[model samples]
Target: MTRLIVAAGGGGDAVAAAMLHAALYGDDERAVILTYAWDRLLVDPLPGPRGPHDFTGLEPLTRSVLSVPPQARPIPPADSTLPRLAAELPHTLALLDPHHGAQGITRQLEELVDHLTPRSVDLLDVGGDILAGGDEPTLKSPLADALTLAACAQTNTPVRLLIAGPGLDGEIPPDDLRPLLGPHIHTFTTADTTSIAAVLDWHPSEATAMLTATARGIRGTCEVRDAGLPVSLTDEGPTVHEVDLDNALDRNTLARSVMTTTTLTEAEAYSREICGFSEIDYERDKAARLKQQPPAKPDLASVLFRLDEFQAEARARGVTHTTLRRLSEVLRLGGSRRDELRSLMVSARPEQYVAPLWRIA
Candidate 1:
């Protein structure tokens, strides 16, 4: 069967969807992976979801059957993490822009159907946050996943909404998801977790990394993307669920609100008013502040000091580790010399727990 999987939440969800495709479908040759450019503001500080400007080689695709031209720019290189990581990956990458919102996504799905003629489409979210009701206090970034879910629910093709790794994103508590997914949840095979673990080595994603770590029975304190919080993943193995897509829009509050939204602005506005948060505003403000400042020169002392601050607050709040690179950016420090600092610090403190950039230094 021809299969197309859209990384419903972007970031690690794209990779997670690819892994799911390989496991469920047996081979990825028949699969086409679609993902958006939005990443954690901590990792990519861009103001808005990048589109044609951020990608390259779409001019020609824009010409041919409008085969959903790549929205990745090759010159300055795309700041969004997934496209850069796509090179080392074996999946065919397609780009989606939230600027187009659900209407644009549905159109892209139709165009992709024209191009690939896929028999099945799975809109995948790695963590169970996609199952959130929007009023959950822990829901951090619900807008992206909600937009995808809302769009796919409207599409004509047979769409399957799959959520793997419950509570991995740390956005929705497992208790919140378990009841809704009780009958729908299924287990991942040993081979599946093994494949997931392999990808963690290639693509450093906080959400997926935590999922794999949990699948391996890793317990105790670990770092996360937020400096003030370190997340604790229990020994529960990851749960993969197949949600009935026909009622997806009516099932979730956020999806229902954005189901009719034609523009990113309207969808974003709804998220702010209905969900009580606006990730778009948060990203834009963060990027604007960074652009206003001259980058602080990278230094060991300042980096270490910031690390200390991150860990102290994180411990106090019972949160996980933050990304070091993002923490570097948070300090207004340049990234070119981050590796040099990492090497030096690795030897200096053997006891220091490091999780790529997602560690409590």
Candidate 2:
């Protein structure tokens, strides 16, 4: 059967889906992945799954390829996560164009299912926010996952919803996640460091990083994306819970609304209206500015200070590693600071370093 695995939310969900697949179904040559390009704009600035605007040229295949920027470097850098995944698990990656939302994605999945003709299609969410009831106070970034779910729900595909690392996304707290899980929950894997360390070794993903840290035995409150409040991810690692799509949608009010959404813009608009913040717009604009006016040459002292803070935070929370790209950008490293930052990243994991501040994840 051609099994399609969908990462409900973007960020590092692409890699997170792969890890989840390995844990649940082992190796399956028929497996393909679908994901988006929404990431922490400050942390990663690469454009996600190309929208219509991104299509310099589009050639469809089992795993499609659409042309990107020529250099995609200095101005408007391409997304960091997907290219990194392509380097490792090239064949498995299938990108969703962001220009369209649920209806468009539903159409795409329908075509993809006909092409792949898989017996089963599994939609995966690393964190359980996709199941949110929509009233959850801290829910952010629900649009992407909701749109994916909404699109998939329109199809006749036998979709199995698997959510791991409940509340790991830092949006919905674990307390709030339990009641929504209902009776359909089934646990397939329980990772405790040893079982899944290699998962991140190849596909180092931040989406799964919080889950990984939990599996590896980190505890207490952890910081996730500067939520302004503590995200309670340090508790339980994750139990892969399987539920029927209808059952899951029933539990999530946001998912239900998202299911009704005909397009991405509509879904995003609804979510932005709910969250009461223009966070997505702000992030998009910030990313745009990064391309047009790259930050000025950074100072070493301040850069080191930020690095010191980041390292301390990671160690405090048991995060295994940090990408040079994330670190340099967080530190605002430039000119001489860039080289100095590179030296530090190389020293930490020299065997896995790539140039231009590229780290494993």
Candidate 3:
């Protein structure tokens, strides 16, 4: 029996979905992943999610649904890692277009279900942010997840909500997520990460990287994102937990509010109304500011100095590790300089953990 997994919230969730598939099905040819083309500011500076129109060479699954093939590329000015993920991941990577909003997403899901006729439909969220109450002060992005939840709730298919690496997104704390989570389904092992190990080297997904790292038995406090949010990596970090679809919808006010949204604009508006802000607005402002600044140059001494200072401070707060993405932010590096920064840091400290993470203590 095949499973249709929805990579809720996109970005790292797609990677997590691949890992989950590996853990559950083990190289199953019948599995399919439906995900959004939304990416981080570092990957896609344009802000927000990219739709079918933003890419070339997408294979149409239905009239409204498109699958991202290995050769598909995001048009210039809009960037993505979906094509790369398609190339690396074993399952078919289908695109989830939110341009038409929740109702449209529901239609697309129904079409996929009818077309594939999977035995089970699963919505996979990398972090537990899909359970957000919309009032969490740390909630940075809720629209995409909310749209996915609302859409899945409307689908005729009985969708299972699987949350891996609870609180890893740094949006909602794990302590805050305990009451919402259901039974622990599975814990990913080192073997489950084999398919995604090389991809993590260049992927800008801090949460999924952390999840896989924890699965590999790396522990302690790890920092992530621009804010350098510290997430405690515990044995539970790699465990997948299931939550009932209806119960999840009941807890997420943003999801309920956007249930009938017909356009991305409408859904984003509800996100702001319910969550007090939309992540896209932050992305738009950041993109505008990025356009004004010149590219950053790699400075090894400055990076080391900043890393020393940050590590001293982070150690005081009990943080032992941090993501390369967070390190790039701390050093004010972006674009190609981020890559250069990683190379310089790795050269300087060969013992540091691989590409996505560095051991500070």
| Total backbone collisions for each predicted model | 15, 5, 0
- Sorted by TM-score, highest first, which candidate order results? 3, 1, 2
Model 3: lDDT to the true structure: 0.87
Please, what is the whole-model Cα lDDT of each candidate in the order they appear? 0.65, 0.58, 0.87
Residues 1-361, candidate 2, lDDT per residue (tens digit)?
Answer: 6568877887367666666666656654536777765555533454334353432233454343231222222224433345545445524566676456576778778878878887678888877888866667776666677778788899867787877877777667777677656344333233433433443443334447667655654444543343323445444445666666887777665556666566556776777666554346666765676678565455555655665677667666655444433554566552224345555655654663422113222
lDDT of 3 by residue, 1-361 (tens): 5789999989689888888887887774557899988886777878899999999999988878899999999999898989988888888889999999899999999999999899788899988999998999989889999999999999997899999999888899898888888999999988888988988888888899999988998898998887778889988898899999899999999999999999999999998898889899999998898888755677778778888898899889888899988888777788545567777888888888553578876
Return the number of clashes found in candidate 2: 5
Which sections of candidate 1 miss by over 4 Å? Answer: 27-30, 59-78, 182-204, 292-298, 301-361
Q: Best-fitting candidate, measured by TM-score?
A: 3
lDDT of 1 by residue, 312-334 (tens): 87667665544444455555564
Order of all candidates by lDDT, from best down to worst?
Answer: 3, 1, 2
Displacement of residue 341 (Cα, Å) in model 2 is: 4.6
Candidate 3: residue 14 Cα off by (Å): 0.5
Q: Which candidate leads in lDDT? A: 3
Off by over 4 Å in 3: 335-337, 354-356
Scanning candidate 2 in windows of ten residues, the lowest lDDT window is: 66-75
Instruction: Give the TM-score of each candidate.
Output: 0.81, 0.74, 0.96
